[model samples]
Target: KKVEEQNFLIRKRVLEYDDVMNQQREIVYEYRDRILEGDDMSGTAREQLGNVVDRIAKDYLEDDFPENWDLHGLYNQLEQMYPIGIDLEELDIESVNRETLIHDLREDIVEAYGDREEELGSELMRALERFILLQIVDERWREHLQNMDYLREGIHLRGFAQIDPLVAYKNDGFEMFTELMNSIWEEFARFIYVVEVETEDHNGAGPTQPAWGSSSNTSSTAAFSYAGGTAADQPSALAAARAGGVPEEIQGAADYAYDEVEAPAHVETRVVDDKERVGRNDPCWCGSGKKFKKCHGA
Candidate 1:
């Protein structure tokens, strides 16, 4: 009967924990469904912009006195996320407050976003916005789930501090979910401003060069012997020869495939030329005062 009661408690605890996850799941699924249904997310984007700006205001302008605020940090935060140029000198420093700062920053950002829409065309910009939001939302939700698992695993430790474990878990979980939503929106907002689009050049007529070497017309194979070649010299020789030196009539062999192989059982040694070999008692050629036997010769 004791074992049965313990089992029931365990099952109840699991269900209670899952209830927390269920609440979060509904929020994430709503985002996914809205995106898939082709909702115009421009309003969502504007709302997120306001949220981010409000956060920046709270972070940098926590003090009532303008002099106490981190104006430089505020400028940097805005510049990094939006392409809008924020000249600190242009801002009216004497009359600045959190509300006015948020308003001006939002205005600049909205203008900058408008400029981007004009540059890319409204249709392309809309498509880019949807793609970025979808990706960030999906990715952040997965990471949030993993983080929640980690939190649940260690949450019972809070009981040692005289806090109820379930209450602590709920409070911490809510904070984490809030942060997850902020990050998803933040990245989605930033990427639309900073992403670069590359266009292909249709006028170029030359054949693309092989990646191994720069020579476009290289068609001959270069053979290298491991026994005779030093590691340092082999790379340059192979690269240079294959780059241009080989005859055009001889086609190149198959490209090299790299695989890990066991080291040879036999130990290999560099063969010293007789003229270069030092006598046992000779002064070291390295210019150390010691005899060869005690120096390199040993």
Candidate 2:
């Protein structure tokens, strides 16, 4: 009975050790890969991805000290150790005291290259890798958004599908996200071909970021300015009326035959004592040289 019990315990230990070993191998591969070719990632996202990795590792390794794993905290440390963008006021990778963050991660990979700490190591590696991928993806996305000035103003793509603008943006944001992920992978592959080791914050903190800049890479853009614009061709009222107008349609011209009426021929004709007055009796000086009774006065 005692011999059988001992054998059962040994078998259980062996299985546990095997699980640990498999996890450690995964951690090593992932860590080394990121150290060689990782880009940059944000803090919050790193924490979240780290949690995912931790959960996956726990499922496989089934460790007893699950509570000891705080990947979010570890990621914060990493960010403080290796920030991204430059700011005159902010600390940069160039000003850091450590050699390289990748070095530290590599050392961690070497030291933890076993099943015993496989779960924790896996979390660390995943967290680091995801952060790197995230940066590339984010840079690409920001560039896309900034370039698409139309989208910056916004689009009602959903409205084309008979949906609301907000709904459309939300729906298309997923498509955008998928494309961003693809861009990240493609960029990662490209970077891996020639990228080399570089210094980052030894404190493991990510960098303070910068504001998004607009890109001039777009093919079509309507550069807008509020300052007095280029003058546009505008039509005069007469031209507009001649082309298409309410008054033109409402009032047609009158063709009155005014051959005998005096008032109709001229307005306010002078009746002063002049040497040659425009007399009606004197052959009607309106050039209708007829007798006064037969002409305008009559």
Candidate 3:
């Protein structure tokens, strides 16, 4: 009874952790779906631009007089982020307040974005926007997940410091999530303004395949080795054990059988070298006891 209670508690904790991840996963998937459905992302891009401008202004203009402002340094930073040319004299800081400067900068940014859209055409610009946003979200989310996992693994150590591990985990996870959101905005702003679009073919070109999934052009086969039972049979045996239909000895045996099985190595497609061409009539390089045409070339 005590062992069963412990197992239940462990499962409950795991489910709690999974619930947090599932909520975040749903939000990301919804964003991706909107992109796939061709939702208008210009508003999102503009919002991110505002965020960038605000951050830059805070960095350079906070608690400083116009005479002491690093206009050249600010220009260099803005130039790196967007294609706009910034001239301090042209901005006429003596005549305009900081609010006006920001408003003018935003207008210039919007105009520059409009020009880029015209250059790329409407359809390609939309596609590029979707691609870039999704790519940045996915990459940053993946890194966030890794950081969360690392935090969870070490969170137990906090117990030694008289802290509750669950509480620590929750607090740290929230902080990490906030940072992730900020990073998403920054990445979107940086890429949207500076991304270069070439005149090459855009048809059938999309985001790169995710690391965990099998490629569309390849087939994956899983192979498992176990001592007591085949992979298919072990699941039913465990179910029976869990249902109390199996005796204690049988349950122990089933658990032992599962523990003895080693983890399966995932299969991936092997890359073939194609630097040198083999003539169809030439001998087979694979050393098959047959003509090239009858062997690999066939």
**Whose TM-score is greatest here?**
1
lDDT of all the models against the reference? 0.67, 0.38, 0.65
Off by over 4 Å in 2: 1-138, 147-149, 152-154, 157-161, 196-298
Show model 3 residue runs off by greater than 4 Å.
1-5, 64-69, 85-104, 200-298
Cα error, candidate 2, residue 190 (Å): 2.1
TM-score per candidate, chains pooled: 0.63, 0.22, 0.57
Candidate 1, number of clashes:
0
- Checking candidate 3 for backbone clashes, the offending pairs are none
Task: Write candidate 2's Cα lDDT for 1-298 as tens digits.
Answer: 9999999988985574345335434543453344334323223333433333333334432333333343344445433322312221233434333223333443432232232124333333333234334445446655655533344245545567777654454445546545554454444323221222222342476642111112232211111111110111111222222333233223333212233443454557767754256464577655666865577667
| Candidate 3 lDDT tens digits, 1-298 | 9999999999999888777778777877777777656576877777667667767866776543677666677778777667774575456666657766777677777777887788866655665566566667777888899999999899999999999888888888888887787778766666666554333222457532111111122111111111222212222223222334344586799898887786576799976676246667877878876667888888
Predicted candidate 2: what Cα RMSD to the true structure? 30.3
How far is each candidate from the true structure, as Cα RMSD in Å?
19.0, 30.3, 23.2
Q: How accurate is candidate 3 locally (lDDT)?
A: 0.65
Candidate 1 TM-score versus the reference: 0.63
Q: Pairs clashing in candidate 1? A: none
Candidate 1 structure quality by residue, lDDT tens digits, 94-180: 787767777777777777878887986664555555545666777788889999999999999999999989999999999999999
* After superposition, candidate 1 runs with Cα above 4 Å error: 1-6, 198-298
